[model samples]
Target: MSQADNLIQRLFSRRAGSLLPLVLLGVLTGIIASLVMMSFLFLLNATLGGLNGKNLEDFEALTWHWQLGLPLAGSLLLILLYRLTPPACQSVGLAYVLERLQFGQGRIPAANIGFQFVAALIALGSGHSVGREGPTVHLGAGIASQIGQLSGRPPSQLRLLLGCGTAAAISAAFNTPLAGVLFAMEVVLMEYSLLGFAPIIAAAITASALTNGLLGTHAILEPVSLSLASYRELPGLLLTGLWVGLLAALFQRLVLVFIRLPLTSRAVRLLLAGAITGGLALVTPQILGSGYDTINLALSDGLPWPLLLGILAAKLLATAAAIGLGVPGGQIAPTLMLGVCAGSVAGALLPGASDPALYALLGMAAMMSAVLHAPLAAIATVLELSLSAEAMLPAMVVVLGANLLCQHGFHLPSLVITQLRVRGQELQTHPLRTALAQRYLSELADMSLVEWSGEGAPPRSKATALVVKRDQHYYLLNPAQLEQRMAPDTLDALLTPERRLQRLERDMSLLDALRTLQDDTGAGFLVPVRRGRGLVTRARLVHMLTEEGGLY
Candidate 1:
């Protein structure tokens, strides 16, 4: 083993009380997950070629192999996978990672991982209309969760480590380390902090190195040449962005609508989705296997105009059906395909048209941004994938625009919306922000009230109580009022039940505390901390909220 690997292994020796152990576990999990994915991918390729007698090119051929052969093969493969694996493994692969986050590390059973791997392989090999990223992501998370469980990490910490595994998988898959790290923070773990950054970055870099060692330097799409026409084209780029964003919105809606068809039999659904993909393949084979060949072909500017729209619609429908049928795969490939189509179509409409290949590259990034709601990652991905200035500059604008449209117009990315739906959370509002607030408040609610501060104090305070008062501009009690109210029965009156008593922590983030306070109608609530705690009067909390713009 290398020094880092050895170091990671040693840290896990004393599994308890150290973050080092979790980091080490993340690295190990990432490496193992990558290897497992590679093996599965290789087997899938071989099976498609050897067992099924279908090569990569066969995926694009207009034949019954995809229509009939794929459905038959996929149905049998799914049946075998379902029979061999547990019932819980049947959902889309990414669902497994989300389940782990909400439940616990041990929630993802080992059998589920094996099932997902096998099922994803079968689906991909059979030419089911799904992407690879989702399966790999789930595989990585399951592996990391297992590692964290073995090392005895807490659920919360393990969740973060799971994010690390997710980051590693993306980095390995796309060779985009920064995007993977950002995705880990933004999507998987849903938090951003120095503490969360370390393990994810380490795991991402480690997995990237390992993946590079195995696969060398080829990306999914070939690098294409791009040249800026002129500053005059900037306005046209903006128009392209608008079109890409709209296409992305349409894509998201289609996926959701199809996936919710409520087909009674999953087997039937798989066959149906396969049949649709096969028919599309019959028309144009370029839509198969991440559409790498078609994307490159489209990028060449030599592709006949007659086939562009048909291929675009076919790939879109195929991917949507593939995922809707509960197949295990990623959405990244489909997202890229959508972008290519959108950009190619948009570019064709422009005067003094640019290279279609350049547009294809831009479309991939723009569509990804819309689907993922991560403009930076999308832009970076295009830059890395194309290595062309023309693709990068326009791609950034397209991604930014698509992200804006998706967030404000459509509300949220499809994955986040799907996750919220699965959790039974309302999607019209910010459910995650509410969940975050609730989690924080729940933790605070469990603590004992230690002290009372802020606002008027009761005339009489108990022996254990620390009374605090706030005047117009100061926190000290009004001495004049205290003296004037100092009656023999003053202490007794202050001790009455009507008087308020609550404890609050000052260090709590205002965002969370405000939400907690809003949920209750009491004058105030008791908050506790390891150190000194104080009461935050209802008025003060309300004032804070008003100033902060509103409750979560």
Candidate 2:
């Protein structure tokens, strides 16, 4: 290796050295993700402007025929695009990123990223009632994974980079850096620690700064002046939370049902979804695209109760169908829109409580928390976007009610986890396993012993463990076993089936190595360390458990 390569390797091999590089990487990830998301937004807006001479989200300006035709054409095009692409490259969005993190060692295909960029543009630009955040996440995580692979980092570090990218994407997309960090921890990483938190926070800040520099400091949602009028309004807020929780549950159930449908053909599914969205769009064009305008309207209390309910019903069906039918977009915006309408309706129904605007904000928090099973992140997003401290108590109450309803009453999993299950993959998380996976077997293997000779000779070294070779197989022999076998003078005794040697790679995680050791009762395992093959036994695990404080 070159001198620089050697220096980098040595630096990363140390814990302290690992931090600076990862933090720098996180910054780079944020900048790149922000640029990518900005480009996506520009392209989408430019396309929409060219087509309709209206704002990117103003599908309402489109003629009735165009509203119906755009999604239908886009669906047909998506079907053709999927057919042309490889099946491996067809997977996109948050669930795909999670699946790769779990089973693919944070390796995302470049083709999938490219496909998502195009597919999301088409889906959103054509008013498919899906949000762009999902594609932004896929693109961002893909970039980070690619960078990590190119850097030749270990799987553990690669996973961290993936989280960094995910946080960066959300930060840039919504201009909510805190929410980005929380989302990465709660939804993507599914765990949090000081080590992971630092880099993710760095990434979120970097991305948010870059996004603001390029796209200006405009929030994704309009800032609203709202608050609970009185403490007595708490009961009404709780009721709104329950209402949103039910809607969230129903939305999840609809999406899950569609995902699990017996239909196998992608084109057929897209066609059915397009038909549903088109039918809904004909009635209420606001249901098309991410419906941010609809949300703004609800927040202003501009839409009457009947109109708000109609939009809510249409958006719910359209978004559920779009997601269930495999549209390459996000559900974050849709959930926000749903929350706004639900909260507005509740506010209108409950007399003398608070402004409908406050209820809209609370509903947004509740739906997001319930559907995604990420209450902390949802609350963070609301606080960051609304910039209203007064909204916090009501948001918390609503979010808690929604969470309790979803978790206890409905027993529904998070949206991404549910999708993962439908794809036959289970998300695994354990504190010990997570800790051990960060450490390689080489770090814990016993390397003090010298190889053992035939029975007559004692081991040259004073090491407690000795490696004995018999018939091309290696076994770890303790001093007692060595003494016991000296009288027998038979190598065959040490070569019993239970005492057979097993091999482990130095780069393998301690957790994986320990799992292998547990599954097979061997004399010991031979780990190919940097210097040479080293002997590892149950004692190594004991050393790791005892020496590595806080691992559990």
**Predicted model with the maximum TM-score:** 2
Q: What are the lDDT scores of the predictions, listed in order?
A: 0.64, 0.81
Q: Report the Cα lDDT for residue 477, model 2.
A: 63
Instruction: Give the C-alpha lDDT of model 1.
Output: 0.64
lDDT of 2: 0.81
What TM-score, to 2 decimals, does candidate 1 have? 0.74
What's model 2's lDDT at 92? 96
- TM per candidate comes to 0.74, 0.87
Clashing pairs in 2: none
- What lDDT is reached at residue 142 by model 2? 95
Worst 10 residues of 2 by lDDT: 8-17
